[model samples]
Target: MPVYVRGPKDIPDTVAQASAAASRVLQSIIKGKIIKSIKDMSLEKIETKAKE
Candidate 1:
Protein backbone atom coordinates (compact mmCIF):
# COMPACT_ATOMS: atom_id res chain seq x y z
CA MET A 1 0.00 0.00 0.00
CA PRO A 2 1.19 3.50 -0.72
CA VAL A 3 1.56 5.88 2.19
CA TYR A 4 0.15 9.37 1.87
CA VAL A 5 1.14 12.41 3.90
CA ARG A 6 -1.20 15.37 4.09
CA GLY A 7 -0.22 18.75 5.52
CA PRO A 8 -1.97 20.72 8.22
CA LYS A 9 -4.63 23.32 7.34
CA ASP A 10 -2.29 26.13 8.30
CA ILE A 11 0.23 26.49 5.48
CA PRO A 12 3.07 27.46 7.83
CA ASP A 13 2.74 24.31 9.95
CA THR A 14 2.01 21.88 7.07
CA VAL A 15 5.53 20.95 6.00
CA ALA A 16 6.86 20.07 9.44
CA GLN A 17 3.78 18.04 10.47
CA ALA A 18 3.69 16.18 7.15
CA SER A 19 7.40 15.35 7.45
CA ALA A 20 6.92 14.04 10.98
CA ALA A 21 3.93 11.93 9.98
CA ALA A 22 5.84 10.48 7.04
CA SER A 23 8.85 9.69 9.23
CA ARG A 24 6.63 7.85 11.72
CA VAL A 25 5.05 5.81 8.92
CA LEU A 26 8.51 4.89 7.61
CA GLN A 27 9.58 3.78 11.09
CA SER A 28 6.52 1.54 11.28
CA ILE A 29 7.47 -0.05 7.96
CA ILE A 30 11.00 -0.65 9.26
CA LYS A 31 9.40 -2.62 12.11
CA GLY A 32 7.83 -5.01 9.54
CA LYS A 33 4.10 -4.41 9.99
CA ILE A 34 1.87 -4.33 6.92
CA ILE A 35 -0.21 -1.23 6.39
CA LYS A 36 -3.74 -2.43 5.56
CA SER A 37 -5.89 -0.47 3.15
CA ILE A 38 -9.37 0.54 4.32
CA LYS A 39 -10.65 0.30 0.77
CA ASP A 40 -10.16 -3.47 0.90
CA MET A 41 -12.45 -3.87 3.88
CA SER A 42 -16.20 -4.08 3.74
CA LEU A 43 -18.19 -1.66 5.87
CA GLU A 44 -20.16 -4.45 7.58
CA LYS A 45 -16.99 -6.34 8.43
CA ILE A 46 -15.36 -3.27 9.84
CA GLU A 47 -18.37 -2.48 11.98
CA THR A 48 -18.56 -6.06 13.26
CA LYS A 49 -14.84 -6.13 14.08
CA ALA A 50 -15.03 -2.82 15.84
CA LYS A 51 -17.91 -4.07 17.96
CA GLU A 52 -15.85 -7.02 19.17
Candidate 2:
Protein backbone atom coordinates (compact mmCIF):
# COMPACT_ATOMS: atom_id res chain seq x y z
CA MET A 1 0.00 0.00 0.00
CA PRO A 2 1.02 3.60 -0.57
CA VAL A 3 1.54 4.88 2.95
CA TYR A 4 1.73 8.65 3.06
CA VAL A 5 3.06 10.32 6.20
CA ARG A 6 2.28 13.99 6.13
CA GLY A 7 3.30 16.93 8.35
CA PRO A 8 6.19 15.07 9.97
CA LYS A 9 8.22 18.27 9.92
CA ASP A 10 5.45 20.37 11.42
CA ILE A 11 4.17 17.95 14.03
CA PRO A 12 5.96 16.77 17.15
CA ASP A 13 8.48 13.94 16.94
CA THR A 14 6.13 11.58 18.80
CA VAL A 15 3.35 12.20 16.27
CA ALA A 16 5.59 11.26 13.39
CA GLN A 17 6.76 8.19 15.28
CA ALA A 18 3.19 7.09 15.92
CA SER A 19 2.32 7.56 12.25
CA ALA A 20 5.22 5.35 11.27
CA ALA A 21 4.10 2.68 13.72
CA ALA A 22 0.56 2.76 12.38
CA SER A 23 1.86 2.52 8.80
CA ARG A 24 3.84 -0.56 9.75
CA VAL A 25 0.80 -2.18 11.35
CA LEU A 26 -1.31 -1.54 8.27
CA GLN A 27 1.38 -2.92 5.98
CA SER A 28 1.65 -6.04 8.13
CA ILE A 29 -2.11 -6.60 8.21
CA ILE A 30 -3.02 -6.02 4.57
CA LYS A 31 -0.25 -7.40 2.43
CA GLY A 32 -1.97 -7.86 -0.93
CA LYS A 33 -4.09 -4.82 -1.61
CA ILE A 34 -3.00 -1.18 -1.88
CA ILE A 35 -5.18 0.73 0.53
CA LYS A 36 -5.27 4.45 -0.19
CA SER A 37 -7.72 5.30 2.57
CA ILE A 38 -9.61 3.65 5.42
CA LYS A 39 -12.79 5.40 4.32
CA ASP A 40 -13.03 2.95 1.40
CA MET A 41 -14.49 0.33 3.73
CA SER A 42 -17.00 0.31 6.53
CA LEU A 43 -15.91 -0.13 10.15
CA GLU A 44 -17.81 -3.41 10.42
CA LYS A 45 -15.99 -4.80 7.38
CA ILE A 46 -12.66 -3.88 8.87
CA GLU A 47 -13.57 -5.39 12.24
CA THR A 48 -14.74 -8.63 10.64
CA LYS A 49 -11.59 -8.97 8.56
CA ALA A 50 -9.35 -8.22 11.51
CA LYS A 51 -10.87 -11.20 13.33
CA GLU A 52 -9.85 -13.49 10.50
TM-score of each: 0.43, 0.38
Lowest lDDT 10-residue stretch of candidate 1: 31-40
Per-residue lDDT for 18-38 in model 2, tens only? 989999888866885445677
6, model 2: CA deviation in Å?
26
Model 1: CA > 4 A from native = 1-10, 35-52
Question: So what's the TM-score on candidate 2?
Answer: 0.38
Please identify model 2 stretches exceeding 4 Å from their true place. 1-11, 32-52
lDDT of 1 by residue, 1-52 (tens): 9676964388657888999999987977797443477688889977875574
Q: All candidates: CA RMSD in angstroms?
A: 10.8, 11.4
| Clash totals in order | 0, 0
lDDT of each: 0.73, 0.76
The candidate maximizing TM-score is: 1
